[model samples]
Target: MQLAVNMLLKCSESNLIERIVWLDDQYCYVVNINEASFPYQLTLEEVIESLQNETKVIVEQDPFVISVEDHELTEAELSKREFAWAIIQSIYVIPAIFDSKLRAQLIKEASEDFGVTKKTVRQYLKRYWARGMTKNSLLPDYMNCGKTISQEKSFTKKPGRPTIYDSAIKRAPVTEEWKKIFRGALEKHYFIKSKPSLKYAYQQMLKESFSKKDFQSGVKVLDLDNAIPTFDQFYYWYRKWYKADYVVRKREGQREYLKNYRAIIGSATEDAKSIGVFAIDATIGDIYLVSTLDKNNVVGRPTIYLIVDIFSRAIVGVSVTLMNMSGESVRVALANCFDNKQAFCKRVLNMDIGEGDWPMHYIPHTILADRGSELISDSLTSLTENLNIKLSNIGPYRPELKGICESYFGILQQHLAPFLPGAVQKDFNKRGGKDYRKLAVLNIQQYTQILVRCIIYYNHRYLEGYPLSKAMIEQNVFPTPIEIFKWGLSRGNGRLIQLSSEQIRSNVLPTGDATVTAKGIRFAGLYYSSKQALKENWFSQARIKGSYKIKIQYDPQDVSVIYLRHDRRNYEVCHLVEYQSMYKNVTLEEVRLLQLNRNQQQADFEHVELNYQIQLAQEIEAIVQQAKAEDDSSLPKDIKAIRHNRKMEKELLINSKYEPNNEPPVFHITPIQKNKLSLFQAKQKEALDDDYQT
Candidate 1:
């Protein structure tokens, strides 16, 4: 039958008069709340008034019902049975639970509900829970009845036959003599081993007195025939004393279920082993990295959204921003994935799941993830479905299903965040750890590149799995996340390729401080030096299109490195400094030095030669005048030597004869030599020369 409040009482207190104090129309009493005293002698009107006042809460009631055919125990009987159940539960111990704490919690709840102090609640608890409490008060004098009351009547059970027994070991008013004995047992048997309840020890000692011995003196024996417990019974006393300290009582069945179920929970996340199986998940956290530039920390300690390729275990796209993550963020991250294909073996499993403008090869075959509405949003799913992706779920609240990304997030928290520049998660964004490391400043794009670089580093450079057997160094393996993605990527479409010969190559400018330097363009915040590239303008005149050395910076905001510059156009490349130097066959400084080293005196010698020639021509004019004046001495010594040599040349020319193998010899030169020697002829020429000079 339902109680007046329409209820079956569960977890309520006991007692018949306390259980059903209301009379229904059938003249049967029942309870809706805490039962009042039966008060059967009161007049009906007085009872009605009393009940009215009781509803105001000076007194309240609990629910109770009576059954015409009953199988459950009576209130009193049920309480007794529950007490036994509690006692059994208390003694049954298990691992993984702190006993005392559980007990304390139950005690606290019960005490508050019953409007009792913790001590009272615990006393009730220990009445059945603490060991040796139930078997107390067997002997007539065991309960101190002889000293405090009539021993025979007070200590005896019905008909004077003893049913329970715990004998007093000694008799005194709160005596200290037995304290030493109890203390010794506590030190050796209880306190020395674990937390000892002084109350439990007292009860244990009293129980021992009833069961084993009462006094050390041979004359004294604890009579078991009419035994009963007294305050002196150590076992009962200890239970009463430390009643509040008992451990909690858990249902045996509940514990068994838990033990077996834990394994099932662990297995829930395991996935099928098949090719093209991939799990995609996003992780938002702070990343740590050595900046490409100063090797300092860069890329803010800001929140980064990383989409890890489950197949390759590679982080294909990272969008780290100062802002919160959104659908657009996911799209951007996916968009950035194509650029990092070589670095990551992970590809999103794309099926007939037709998606956005995404290249077909980049699509995933199966996207395994949770059903978080974010993943199922039309924007996301439409793309997945369009790309022919077969979607599987890890189930809600089960992150371990996509464990690679989860583990990746964990690794980020432990290994990377701490090493990052600035106050990592707290103030990393403001300080720009990644940006500071590479560019000495934060430009959202470049900083993110730094973070991506960190991932690449983790994959290729980090040591993972087991330590090496032969070498002192560990085996460096790709990050497992990247490995997973790569495995997926390798299994996917083979039709996708880089630029082909049939297609005209569109060159992309080096981004960031990515200007063509003697070094290659900056990417992911790192400036990669390339030998083939000319300084600053390599992209502009790129006759042959090729992937330029990309200076990488992990973009904390997103997966794609910003490649520093905002523009996509190519810039003309200047000659690399090496080429200029090699072509000139000299250093620029050497050329300048040689030009500056000329002597002024050597240069003046050319003027000296020209002046000498002019003076000689004038001297020849003066010689003609001198001959008219008959002054031969005016000419300088060297010139007179040169004239004498010339005069000798004319005489030789006039007198020389040709001799050959033939018989002919020249004989005509004799007349001129003869005329030169003749004094009369010399006198005639001198007269003629004087006339001409005049």
Candidate 2:
């Protein structure tokens, strides 16, 4: 019953009155919301009387009401909002705003100021008062202006302009019969597997629907000059009847529609409550890399595995290796993800990282991956199952399901790769083109460091067009991956799973069988030993019981250590033995390569060794023949005489001292020193001679 600005009153079902301003205690200025009219003075008593009699009611809603923060203002709405505000801004404070003469003068002044008619100013003022007196109230009524062609209208001639070239030509109205023909032709020709163009479809429709059969040739000819609708008319009806989705599906097939044309119903972050879902994928880096062992050796493109937190779009984990994309590589990347980021950056990269520079280092609750052989392997299954982590594989060829991870790959390969050395250019495969592989400079380790730097930058980079939640917007959270990640950790359920590095490795590392022999525990043709193995006397047992296989987990990236899995979460760490030290700090792949080279070298040397042995045997046979020819058999024929002669030869050989070139003795034989002076020294000595001379 009380009058206030923007207050709504329903005088009837069709009439809505908005109170603009109070003229006095008994009267107030009001405006009709639906029609273009100036503000009119209405008595307060009339509204109160209507309310008392139940003839009018208060309306709470204004149809034109909108929140500026929520709705995007179009250019039309912006122009109107500014125009209305400009007009009302000057006259809204006037004391005699409701006075007819004063209102007319102010309207005239506003019209001149804005280069609009006086009626336009009055209409804008009325709208401002009627629709809650807000800037949005002046927004253009676009919904009312452009109407959908949902219902057909009857036309006498045509509902559009005449032909530009031939206005005098008569055209028939599009009737129900023509509409039926249009639908049939569109479905049969346009919306089909062939997906013929609109013009082609129209020509086909004319040929089939409005053609005459020739008697002699029995060929149907199209009616080009008359009797059929125009392509524009046919297209209009087709658009109205067949929606974009149906058209795409029928023309392009269901798979194409689902993959490319389907509407996005929700966001990747919709179900992500925290750091729970991480999407992992692999790509062959566009740039070729050199070998970590020898820089001159081109290692081809490195297989890069990236783990991204879907909710925050942060690059949580990255792995660059010369190994192929397989379950082992995925495991190594996952292990790195679960390891302490600070220690990893320092130990492997030898680079210092500040606090929160690359803070993502926890295992996510669920991992989303593509249907790669590596991801769907039994090894990955066992690893995730043992660690209580969920693994999900997306449908084949559906990259949009894991869009954030794929987007990062595109950014890296397409956007960032062009600037790097040895990057695969588009024309590299063309005939007589330069080979980009020869330009390789960075090794796997150096490339990984560069990737780390890029990832750190990506994490902290401010995101544009990010879909922030209402609560996050209210809290004024920055739209950066790192900031969003931090916010999610604090605001969400904090589902990131934290575990010891050993526990993660025990489950995630690749597993193989190692034989326990008398000498050592052997794996990959190399020896390993652990304190636990020694304490359990495994080697001694193996010696007694013969060698046996024991299941162990190892890092393919480094062959120095392997884990003996005692149970699900327990492991005994083993290291390479002293004799196997040559394989230390080398990958399993490298070890295999070295073993192959060693085998080839030995094979090459085997023939040479055999030739030397054969020559030595021939020489021995020749010596025996020469001894038989020069035999002294008659000298010692009896057994006792031969034995006596052998003893004499042995004694002579022991007593003889051989010297070369009659020079100083090769063997310096010193006489044994006597405890006291010898008799010869007493008879003649240098010291006695010196005393005599003195």
Q: Write the per-residue lDDT of candidate 1 for residues 276-322, one digit (tens) a residue.
A: 34455565454333322223333333445555544345554554544
TM-score of each: 0.26, 0.50
Quote model 1's TM-score: 0.26
Candidate 2 local Cα displacement, residue 271, angstroms: 1.5
lDDT of 2 by residue, 1-694 (tens): 4344444668765565564433444565677777746677777788778878867776654454432321234456667666677777777654566778887888888788878898788777777666655445566665446644565578877668777795433467799988888888777878878778988888888888888887788999755456557777888888767768778879998768757875332234445656568899998889987765566867678788999998889998888776798988998899888877787776556678886798777667678887677886655765664444677767687899889998898787776676689988878899988798899997666777788888889999999998998978999999999989877765324445444456556556677899999989999888899999899999999999999999888877677888887743356789889887766555677566557767998999999999999999999999999999999763434464477558766655555544334344233323542422274466557656877899
Q: What are the RMSDs of all candidates, in order?
A: 37.6, 29.7
State model 1's lDDT. Answer: 0.39
lDDT of each: 0.39, 0.73
Best by lDDT: 2
**Model 2: worst 10 consecutive residues (lDDT sum):** 64-73
Model 2 clashing residue pairs (backbone): none
